[model samples]
Target chain A: MIDIFTKFSGQLFVGLGWTILSSVIALFFSLIIGTVFAIMEVVPSKIARFIGRAYVEILRNIPLLVITMFFYLVIPKYVMKINGFTAGTIGLTLYTSAFIAETIRSGIQSVSGGQMEGARSTGMTYWQAMRYIILPQAFKIVIPPLGNQFVNLVKNSSVLAFVAGFDLMYQANSIASTTFDQINSYLVVGVLYLIITLPLSYYMQYLEKKLA
Target chain B: MSMIEFHDVQKYYGHFHALHDINLEIDEGETVVLIGPSGSGKSTLVRTVNGLETIQKGQLIVNGHDLSDPKTNLNILRSDVGMVFQHFNLYKNKDVLENIMLAPRIVSHIPEEENKKRAMELLEMVGLEKWAHNMPSQISGGQKQRVAIARTLAMRPKLILYDEPTSALDPEMIDDVLQVIKKVTNESGMTSLIVTHEMGFAKEVANRVIFMDQGQIVEDENSASFFEQPKTVRAQQFLSKIISH
Candidate 1:
């Protein structure tokens, strides 16, 4: 067991690299997509709001693994030949964006109606008021909840394993199967997950306090 | 030309008429006070001039822009018509100075230095120059309302609307806010429309008083005439009740 652990330590580090890569990709795209959807949800146009609501409902209700599988297994078979890593990252982004949209929508709503009225009464166009006054205040209110979504996004990247995405959990599974050291292999993987999640959790808490 | 004109203006909040066949005019530099019991639509009437509340029927014109026309550019109308809400409604995230400067900087596209000078001047006028950097949350209710007034004045609007500006303040604080308002309206020659429960402030500061009840204007008279001998029974009852308290 000890020898197996020593031998697989390098692979664990490599898996850590894939996990970090997946998380970074998902975080980058999700924030952009989420912000777009959030804007759409708040915009006065009926069609825009409907589209935004439909996207959030559809993405949020489906299981993350199902979304990953749809992209990995279903899409490549017919529409495109995307690989597991791309598939998993796309799935993660879509899933996380739905939650972020809801979080940001509530944040925007939490800002007092008087603020918008005050801004509009001062001759600001709707978009101008939203950009300058409403969004700045909404972003502040959404920070703590947004941090939680980000941390969850990082952990949810493990769904990459089911699609042969070569992430941490995938490497852990391969090591455990080959080495026949199930408990120890998973224990090591669990520690690796903790190593990623613990600091992320701490950082989010730190940000919440700093922003507050 | 009249600064504001509401010609047969009507508003309904889903079958409940909020403003009923309102026809009135406010000339430039005239200080008109609207006095009424709660739910009498005084606030709603003033809010329509700024297009905060849309009038569902007839022409509502401010500074030559017809609010009843969908094609009318409300933003331009609002730029010339400023409002100070009863609750102050100061942006809580901003400091007193930022609250005053934000509209000028963002909406008017005024240069930062120039806007700061104007904001400082308004703050000094309101006697809150010392609280420039203090957040709205840090200020008293009266101070916040005064800052709200200063914020309105920063735009140099042709007309200003005060919607029960002293109604939300404590008894001790109401006088201070009223005094600032009195000084501003007295000194600026700006067209002012105030909806207030403070009869004394209205008598002292307003040139004319309009009494409203059940979404209708009961009487429109000069301040001395309105207070000394209210013609309508509703106006008399409202004044008696308010004065008794």
Candidate 2:
């Protein structure tokens, strides 16, 4: 037991690097997808809103493992060959985007109807009002919820392990299987996850204070 | 032709029948005051001219655009006919100067310095020149409404719609806003449609007074005649109730 703990401690730092990589990739793409979907959801046309709604509903309801597996196992067979890290990062982006869309949509709705009317009355088109007035106010409203989605995306990247993604969880799984030290290996990974998530959590808190 | 006309206009909110067959006209540079009970559709009538609220059936021609026609480009009409809301609806996120300058810069596409100059001029007109940098949240209701008026003026609209402009204001603050409004209408000759409960302001500033009840115009006359000899029973009843309080 002591030997396993001693070995795992040094390897845990290696796992931390993978976790950080996964989180950065996932956060960047999720923000892009989330912003696109958020804009689509608020668009005037019925078809645009329907398409946005369909994407959010379908992605949000499915489990992260199922989505990761679809990208890892299904896509590679039918379409192009892709690595596990690419598959997992794509899955994390899609899943986190759905939640982020919901958060941003609610934020947009919370802005007063009068603001839209005021902007429109001044001859601004719908898109212009949304871009200049509505979205800025909505961003202030959704900051806390958006922060939660980012933190959850980091944790949810563990779904990568199911498909041989070289993220922290995958490294922890391999170390446990080879050494027959499941408890120590997972404990190390848990600490590594905390290292990534704790700072992210604090950073979000700092942002909320600064913005408020 | 009249600069503005409402012919047999009607509006319904889920069968509530908010405005009945309303017919009216205002000539160029005419300032009309609409006064009535709370649910009398006074606000709705003025809002329709700006195309803020659509009329269910009837012809509303304002500044040459037919509002009843679905093909009318309302954004263009809105630029010609600006509205001041009851709540002052100043952009809470923007300061008074930005609130005044935004429409001219974006909608009118005026250059920044020119727009800023016009915004400052309007702010001075409304006596809010010193508070240009203050956010709407930091200002008093009267100051906010004055800023809202300046914002409307910045658009250089042919007509201004005032929907209960002073009703939401404090009693002392009401005179300040009313004074600014009077100064604008007197100086600019910009046609205006004001919906207000301030009978004194109505009598003082209005060229004509319209009394509405249950969505129909009961009396339309000069402000002096409307107050002195109200021809309709409904107008008399409304005046008695308003003046008694």
Candidate 3:
């Protein structure tokens, strides 16, 4: 293990950087997309709700790797040219957004209906009430679940390995192939993932407590 | 001119009729109490004023807006109509002060400095000034209702609706919430339509009382006369039932 770390430290760090970058990008885009779809699912218009429901249902049911592969292999061949990293990140974002939308929609529903009534009775518009009163409460209610989704999202970024996006898992594969020390290589990768996930788990718990 | 007018208003929840042939008028500055057994449409009628519930058939005009018109803008009317609910419904994400100041700031665009000043004054009026920073969950039920009242009053609405505001509180907490409402209405001279089972409080604050049964107004009379001699048989039975308990 020590020898593998000493020889592959630079490659491992590069992989770690790429993993972090992809996760951050996916997290940011996914949250916005998820929230929009969540709102659409609940809005008064049936058409909007249908669109939101369809998006969430279709994307969430598809396997994440298949979606990633389509973007990687198909989009480049059909209409546009893009790198493996871009394709993987977009796939991750859309897939994770579907789950986030579901989480947030449930959170929104959990808030008392009276909150919207109270806000609207004060003369706030529907969107206004939703923005100020409903969404804030919904987000608070969903923090724990959302934190779970975020952790899942980060781990799932490992899907990038199959597409040559060069994430941590990709580095482990390369190191194992070169060094013939598969156990130690993958072990190092697993520990690094723990380093990311454990702190995130703790931070979410802290946030839930502080908000409560 | 009357502040609210409902001419032959009818509401239906699919096959079940909720409000039927409702012809009513509420003048400005008049405090009216609406009393009825559960499912009697008192709540449904009050909600229609704020467009929380829409009337199906009839002309309903509130604060000069013809609510029956498809183009009527309800948001404009809502700004001048405040509502206090049985559940209090204070914004759980906001502190007491923010709950009071939010509508005034966002809906009406009151200047921050002035909005804060008026919010504090309203808080003081409700006797919850010290609870300015407390979250809704941290407060007692009565205190939360007071904050909710302050929140409604912050909009400076010309009319206020109380939908069984004290019904959800403990027996001991009811008086505190009622007292704040009494003081607020008297000081502001705002038109109020209250739906409550608190007969004593209704008799004290209401100039007139309306009795409802099975989605119809059975009697509308002066509070003093109605309490002393309820005209309709339904009103008599209803009053006796509630007063006995």
Q: What's each prediction's TM-score? A: 0.96, 0.95, 0.97
**lDDT (Cα, tens digit) per residue for candidate 3, span B94-212:** 99999999999999999999999999998998888998998898999999998999999899999999999999999999999999889987888999999999999999999999999
Candidate 2 residue runs with Cα over 4 Å from true position? A1-14
Q: Give the distance in Å from residue B159's predicted Cα in candidate 3 to where it truly belongs.
A: 0.7
Candidate 2 lDDT tens digits, A1-212: 45655766556556667667888988988887887898899887899999999999999999998998999989999999988888988899899999988899889989999999888888878887888889888988888889899889989999888877777898888899998889987877787788788888899889889978
Candidate 1 displacement at residue B154 in angstroms: 1.2
Clashing pairs in 1: none
Tens digits of lDDT, candidate 1, B4-116:
88899889999999999998998989999998989999999998888888888999888889889989988888888889998887887788999999889888899999999
CAPRI tier of model 2: medium
Each prediction's DockQ? 0.71, 0.73, 0.86
Consecutive 10-residue window with the lowest summed lDDT within model 2 chain B: B43-52
lDDT of 2 by residue, B95-118 (tens): 899998988888889999999998
DockQ: the better of candidates 2 and 3: 3
Clashing pairs in 2: none
Clashing residue pairs in candidate 3 are none
